[model samples]
Target: MISIGHSPDADDLFMYYAIVFGWVGDDLEEKFENQALDIETLNIATIQGIYDVSAISFGAYPFVRENFALLQTGVSFGDGYGPKLIRKKTTQLKKNFRVALSGVHTTNAIIFRLAYPEARIVYKNFLEIESAVISGEVDAGVLIHESILNFDTSLEVEREIWDIWCEKAQEELPLPLGGMALRRSIPLNKAINIESTLTKAVEVAVKNKKILSKMLIERGVIRVDEKELDIYLDLYANKDSISLNDLQKKGINKLFELGFKAGIYDVLLECEDYFIPTGYQALRNS
Candidate 1:
């Protein structure tokens, strides 16, 4: 009886769960019977113990640390989905500049600081940031989530913060887009099994080509272009990259470096047995 929570951007993986977890036909009603609300709402509701597993943004790390006991691991959309430093198509950042973000404590804010340490960062909602950038409220804005896909290219991409991280780290670092995490109350063995199951499901979905295409079409999150969907899935559904060990050590280290450089966090919070040893080895071998 796992109560899973995620954002709308994760609908494709949710649909895969609907198929693999026997929730698609008459079982759909039973599977999500206890779902409190949408992913964002449910994550907020985590303070009330409404869910055991959650998919949360990296920007929510500070909140999660203060509010919950959980382990962060699993599949993510990768670094490409990180915040983009954008300016007007004609504008450029010569020296220091003012940057608008979705929120002060949001993930984009953290990424913006890491990428442009010299810039002045301001907070704004997603819609407001778009308007602000266009209206010249700020010199540039950091965009995230669906905004990356839906953004009007009239705004030029100054730099992708994740791309910068990749260049600096010299590895294809997972940008903690979001992934499944379990509360401390859940048994450790059960959490391991669930993680293994999800890893396998993603692999199967990736291989099945047809299922991946159908999922994108059914969700309407993206247009009905197989090539586009393929690219998205390939970027997000990285089978070998989803493991507790990599996320805890490699992934967390990279994020910590970014956070420290950006001044969003002081240091990475340590966790015990954060990675499953066998799973880590398998990912390495693959």
Candidate 2:
């Protein structure tokens, strides 16, 4: 059995249910067990080499590079929008403003740190961030996942993480948020088969989006209402998420570069160099 870890958000639910529903990879002999958790928990778990496959922040990849190979499919990117920094009142932030971030290792936290280096930081679950801000536990908070869409009226926009990412990037690229990673400890042939199965799962999910979304709603698996879930899937789990294209690859590399320059990671990583070597399977079959 292969264990998989993914977030409980709508986008992840949308991408992963194709596999859960047995819509893909029927020929594969491996059985998958899925675990739904918050992204921060999964990130920390990936660092420990806990799951055979997992969804992780792109920002967390460098730290887990030794044990995990980034998967080509099931990626989330922001074209011109992403995590939001919200405040209870519209006021100028002090140099040492207290901020609640989803996690220390999240992509939003990495970008937010670069943008506001002097801010005091605290870690909170994405679900608790809005309440943290409303209750004034922190002066501001960076909202990730679905929280980006449905914030309370009492809260106001402080900034967008995408704006910070754009400011720091060398060229315009989609903001890399999260993607799946496979444990490198798995045998190469099995890893290739698993990757192929997952790639097909993403494709099938996108093709059957409406049917799948209805099923998810009926099952009460998602947090948002049907309309909100539809919008969330369009933003994070569309066809572009099926695999890494050239542009998405560049975007991920740029994010790694940014992290390296900021001293968040010791070495710069080329996104493609770390992927599972599926071509070996082709060579073997040839």
Candidate 3:
């Protein structure tokens, strides 16, 4: 059995549930089981090599490349928008202002650090960030996940992480936020097969979007209700999330370059070097 792990957020669930629901078909040589955790927890578990496959932050990928290889499918990227930095009304932020981050290793946090190197940072669960800011626990907090949509009215967006990405990325690349990773020790054939299966799962989910959304809501598999979940899924689990394209690959490489330059990584590495090999299937078919 292969253990797959992903965040409990609606986007992650939406991308993976077709396989969970048996809609991907039962023609697998390996059995699959899934577990859900918060993104931070999943990233930490990735350090331990806990799952055969797991959803990991792009920021954390640089550190774990030896243990996990990037999977092209099941990714989340942002075009014109992404996580928001917010604070209670009229609270001006200074360069040295303290901020609450989802986690030190999240993609948003990575950009936030590079953008505001002097800002004092404290890590908190994504859910508690708004209250922490409102209670004056910190000068600001970076809101991620579904919180970017319909946040507390009292708070205001200071700026978006996407804006930072645009300034840093000269290329017209979307910001790579999260994607699935496979354990490097797995056989190349099995790893490639799993990646293909996941790509199909995402395609099926997007093709049958309404039905899956209703089922997810009815089964309480996601946090948001119908309308909000619909918006969230469209933002993160759309056609682009089905597989990595050339731009998506460049986006990830950009992230690695930035992280390495900022001293977050010990070495720079290419994203393509770690992806599961796909040429084997073509070779056999030929």
Candidate 4:
């Protein structure tokens, strides 16, 4: 059995559940066992080489480049919106304000730190960030996943992380959030097969999004209700997520460059160079 680790967020569930439901890859000999954890936990697990395949924050990918190569499918991007930095209404943030972030290794945290170098940061689970801000546990907190959509009225948006991404990007590009990566130790042929299967799984999921969404709601598999889940899926789990198009690949490269320039990475790596070479499968068969 191949182990898979992903966030329990609606987007991750939307992309991965087709495999669980046996709607795709039924002909393959491999069996997939999935574990749902918070994105931060999955990021740490990916760096440790714990799962054969995992969903990881793009910011965390540079550290694990040697052991894991990115998969083309199952990526999340923010076009014009993303994680929100929120604080209690009528409160003004100081330069050294204490803030709660989802995790130290998350993409939002990494970018948030770069944007607010003087801010004091504490790590908390994504679920706790909103409450932390409300209770004065911190001056502000970054809300991710579904929290970005339906935050409490008492809290107000301080800034959007996507704005920071745009300023740093210096060009039009989607904000690269998270993606799937496969362990490089897997044999090339088997790796190719697995990537193909997973790619199809994502495509199938997008094609049958309505059907799958209903199934998830009926089974109580996702945290959000149908309306919230539908909106979240469109933002993060749509057709663009099925594979890395040229633009998305460029976006990932830009993220790596940004991380490298900020001293978060030792080297600047091209994102496409690290993907599993599926073309090799055809060559070997021929």
The TM-score values for the models, in the order shown, are 0.70, 0.98, 0.97, 0.98
| Model 1 TM-score on a 0 to 1 scale | 0.70
Residue lDDT tens for model 1, 229-256: 5655556655533444544356656665
**Better-scoring candidate (TM-score), 1 or 3:** 3
Candidate number that wins on lDDT, 1 or 3: 3
User: lDDT tens digits, residues 33-69, model 2?
Assistant: 9999999999999999999999999999999999899
lDDT of 3 by residue, 113-164 (tens): 9899999999988888999999899989998889888778789999889998
Tens digits of per-residue lDDT for model 4 on 1-286?
Answer: 8899989999998899998999887877778999999999999999889999999998899888999998999989999989999999978999999999998888899889889999999999999999999999999999999999898899999999999888888987988998998999989988888888888989999999999999999999888888999899999999999998898888889988988899988999999789998888778889
Q: What lDDT score goes with residue 199 in model 2?
A: 87
Clashing pairs in model 2? none
lDDT (C-alpha) at residue 54 in model 1: 64
lDDT of residue 27 for candidate 4:
74
What's model 2's overall lDDT? 0.92
Candidate 3 is scored at a TM of: 0.97
Give lDDT per model, in order. 0.57, 0.92, 0.90, 0.91
Root mean square deviation (Cα) for candidate 1 = 5.7
Give the worst 10-residue stretch by lDDT in candidate 3: 164-173
Cα error, residue 57 of model 2, in Å, equals 0.4
After aligning candidate 2 to the native by TM-score, how far in Å is the CA of 224 from where it should be? 0.5
